[model samples]
Target: MANRLKRTSEGFISYRFAAIVIAALFFASLAGWIAQELVPPDFVERKAFYGESWRPGLARAVDLLRLHDPFHSLWYRFVLAFFFAVLVACNVSRFRRIALRSLRAELPAGAEELRKRPLSFDLSWRSLAAGPRGDADPLVRYGELHGRREAVDPAALEGFFARVSALLKRRGLRVVSDRADGVIRFTASSGRLRSPGTMLLHAGIVVITIGGLIGSLFGWRGMVYLKAGETAPLPPDSAAVLRVDEFRIVTGHGGAIRSYVSTVTILGTRGETLAAGSIEVNRPLGYKGVNIHQSSYTMGEGEFARASVSYRLRGETGRRTVELRGTASAVLGDGAAVVTALRFLPDFRMGPEGAFSASPFPANPALEVEVSAAGGAQRGWLFLRHPDFNARFAAGIDLALDGVEPVYYTGLELSSNPGAPVLMAGFAAATIGLIFMYFCNPRVIRGIATREGLIAAGVESRWKASFELEFAGIREAIRREFDESG
Candidate 1:
């Protein structure tokens, strides 16, 4: 053991790498926090809008957390990497020590080494069954109100010497052959003699950590929404294409809006169909490694009344301004998909007795539209629920349904976390191991016997108040066995 300890002192066991790594992490975290505070933000406010910015009514949002990206920061990664390294090194350092201390190790050649450890017992078995029965003194019967019990009662120890010796010999109780020794040594530690629970806990942590590393290396996560008729691309690792066939919001029994359901079709990268599923609030669509969430829906209807145009065709291009209600004719030539502010609904609603009326969420939707150019009062009052709302407007041109804007699902978030499996496995293993270690029950007996009239002795049990209960139980069992046997 001295030599082993000496050898272990060479590397991690003595060098204290864990302490060093922890200190490094402490400093690194501090430095990162300071740097984050000291450095001026590398950001431009009110910058020109890019393809990622700008919305209908809201202004473009400024990106803040992106600057110096704390999570992706170099210092943060260095600290985490160093900490993980220390954990692995610590485990490796202890692995050798753990292997050397196995339960299969043989008992020492001399009990002297064990004797110095506060373990001693002077027990004799003789006072059983009024006398010894050749080599079977303890193996006798006792009186039972129902049936006799054939148990070893040691109260007959005095007359059962020869039989006791034989029993001990059969049990492999070896008396030492050392220098004039007649004392016998019995080593029996109840409950758990070998405690390896801590080692198992350490190993469980290692597995969980390694699993976390695997998940971090290979896990892919992203979110997408499929509005009606729209196709969305999967993440970099996905092989499927998702299309939202139809999305609708259905309220509860009393129109409480229980949830919004979306019918989605999963298409392979090569345009082949793979799967179809419906997703709703709280219920997400999962396929392979991707998850599609039913985020939101919107519906608005208006006519193709007035159209905004590039003045370039009208011999004016740079002169752009907000088109006021009723008199704005910046038209595009040759009639492409015309861009026009057909009409606007501040408070829109759709249901029975629902329309763009004066009442809030109007009972009847109205279209105040104007033609784009050189034409009569031919416009569109495209009803959201009813596609035939085209006829409800000023007539001339047949109002054909070019396209109706659907509702948008907002704040839809998605991501895949593989760490869940690892965490769950670790928790389960620890719970089961602990239960096995502490819950198993054990029983033991002790007695003394004499010739004339033997006296009952004691017993013991684990997992409760042991001493008194064990003695009482042994006395009763002895009395009952004697009564029944006679």
Candidate 2:
């Protein structure tokens, strides 16, 4: 009844609640699949973060599941939380039983339970050389037990059974009968039950991984896109900052992008530079518990940019703005300077729609730069890049436009969470549990007999063929002894 109660509880937990959690995970995966199939094309705009497009339909899905970062979603957290809870409960319940067993100083033998087990049996056989003395001979049992029925004699089978019986008794089983009919039985057990701990040890790993899943839900991953020649501070704890010093993209023969490289300085909390590295796809920079990689590339040129620092005073509102692109002509109240679009590339696309909208490469690389002193237009088209690269303004105000070096860089992904490790451990535990309980249950044998010349075989459980093989060897030894005596 105790075993039945335990079994019923496990059944309810495993098939009812556990099954439901598993089903929910299954449904979640199915929904994710459907989302993958339908949501992408319907979305018209692309978000640089998480690579999702800005579309009417995806906003709700993305926000609710945190699809911007799905693995860090609530659904995953809910399932993993339940899984960990189940594991904790299972460990507690199982250990409670182990605690009880441990309290006993040692395993006690219920002699009655050991004897009169269901598989008890008996057999009878007559000797070829018959006499009451045949029974009196001490070698009589040994000879018949010797078990080489075709070689020594049937008598050896009896002796072989006796030796095997003694070996079993030493192992703490009570022998019920040993006879010459090639049959033997004994009852045995070991705290060998303690060997079951292999299950717990293996399950521990999955528990750790489940813990990792929980961490991720509470965790966050943010990206820092650093362009060459520029820097931006990262978001707090949920953010990490890095500066891209140099960026390069190696392309295939036909200009298909093959690989990219970005040299950057990684920053930890408080805007501190933690490490400097050259990052790429397979090669990521790990520092401060985050990984940064060169995930993308873009085209832009950095030249000796000549720009006037123009700013409207603190209280000057309403269109009183000072914006600098390259060098531009501007009258700052009473001052004047030159404004030239320096180191101009042909095409630059930015925001939903903005300037530099043409092809950013050399196809139409032309800069229409204007230089005005004291609020007037003195503008001209400058072919700044060339096989010759020589383009300048008329009559020395001295603005030397130098070589335009391209700026290449990428976005770095930073993430940290504690849940992944726990989920992994739980997965490992369940695997080990099944293997130990199913693959290694020991066999309990009990022996008895109804006749003098025959042994009986009995067991509480069927074992692997090992039992049959051992029994056959014993029978052969007995037959050999009997044949020799005859």
Query: What are the runs in model 1 whose C-alpha is more than 4 Å off?
Result: 1-72, 96-102, 105-197, 237-239, 248-260, 269-271, 280-284, 293-406, 410-486
Model 2 TM: 0.48
Judged by lDDT, which candidate is best?
Answer: 2
Candidate 2 vs. truth: CA RMSD? 12.6
351-404 in candidate 1: lDDT tens per residue?
A: 587455333232344443444444444554443344455443222222322332
Model 1 TM-score? Answer: 0.45
Cα error of candidate 1 at position 209, Å: 3.0
Q: Rate the local accuracy (lDDT) of all candidates.
A: 0.47, 0.51
- Mind giving the per-residue lDDT tens digits that candidate 2 earns over 1-486? 999998877864554766676677777766666665654543325544324444565566566675444444778767756665665665655676555543432311333443454443222234423334455666654665664232334456555556556666664554454233433333343333433544365356446655764774676677666677566554445465567787777798899877788888766667776778888888987765555655555445533233222233324443233334544444433454446454355553335653353643544344445655544545544443332333343422233223344444466676655565566666666566556556654445544322244343434334646656654544444344344343
Supply the global lDDT for candidate 1: 0.47
